[model samples]
Target: MRQLLQRLNNNSLYVIISLLIFGKGLGFCLNRKFFFYPPQFAWLMNNVFLDYSMMIAGIGLLVYVCLPSNNNFVLGVLLAIITVLLAIITCIEIEHVIFAGEIEFVQNAISNSAIIGFILWTARHYSKR
Candidate 1:
């Protein structure tokens, strides 16, 4: 059990993923009554943008954990690229989702965010050294 736990903590991708997910989940739990989104930002934080952000964050988590040991640069590059993609996609999709009145994106976003949370937790269980 100790050995298994040690292996998980050494994974950086897992740590990032966990934090991102925790961040997203925090948002949802804080605004449970608002099933869709806040009225003040109806033009922003649309379902599409939210989903896209979650996806990008998810991708970041994947690349962080998937890169080879000698490919730290590659892993970092991938994470950066995916994060940018997520941000860009979210910005563009926000207006569209708002106009269309579709809010299903939150569902996908939350699901993916939860996945990141678990991966992050597992990663943190391993050895840091």
Candidate 2:
């Protein structure tokens, strides 16, 4: 019974992580329209590489999460990659606010930070198992 419960918990965690990755990926794909049209986000408008990289990373992470494995090292590496990407994005948003005097991107930065926190928490949860 304890083993069954543990399996259920792990499965649920995977599902939650998968959902978050999918939502974030979809948001990245859809937000291109908004980023392109907005003058405040002009810096990101021409950066197609960054946009594509984000989508690819999301897909890769989702695939990794779906795989049946108990390897913490691989998970940690993936999380680190994601953290770096998000940090880069957050820094860009902060730069926009500082240079353009726009506070709109601050919300994005906050959201990114929250996601990072959630990822860390998820990693810690898995490490305990």
Candidate 3:
């Protein structure tokens, strides 16, 4: 397990996770009805603007992860934006748990938190280069 983890570098992990997020964002934008929203989150049920914003943020995260780290300023700005967006999403997931009393929302909350951690790890790796 340790060897497998050692082989998975930060950038590769970031790209893989970003692709998953991109897929989720695409699904959110293209088929909002497919997702199950608790009554408390009714505002998220058919919010096209939020859906597109998520997709755009996913795209931005993908681009940020893939781009060369030649310029720290651009990468830092992107990282900040991505971090804020992800934090917001994670907060919403936590809110769902609080408002709806659903334990399942914890999975999404944890996943988003992990993604944020990976993003920060990747950023740290790049900054060290």
Q: How displaced is residue 86 in candidate 2, in Å?
A: 1.1
**Model 1 steric clash pairs:** 5-125, 6-126, 6-127, 7-126, 8-123, 8-126, 9-125, 9-126
Give per-residue CA lDDT, model 1, range 1-129, as digits (tens). Answer: 564444445565455653564465446435544433346665454444554455556555554454434454554454554455444445434533566565665555455545534544543453323
* RMSD of model 1 against the true structure: 10.0
**Residue lDDT tens for model 2, 1-129:** 676556546556544554565566566666665443347566654465665666666666656655655677776776677667777777777777777667898898899888878877877765524
Q: What RMSD does each model have against the real structure?
A: 10.0, 4.4, 6.2
- True-vs-predicted CA distance for residue 85, candidate 2, Å: 1.3
Off by over 4 Å in 2: 1-18, 33-45
Residue-level lDDT of model 3, residues 34-123, one tens digit each, is: 333465566765576665666666677556655544467766676666677678778877876887676787998999899888878877
Ranking by lDDT: 3, 2, 1
Against the reference, the lDDT scores of all candidates come to 0.49, 0.65, 0.66
Name the lDDT of candidate 2: 0.65
Off by over 4 Å in 3: 1-14, 34-41, 44-46, 61-69, 127-129
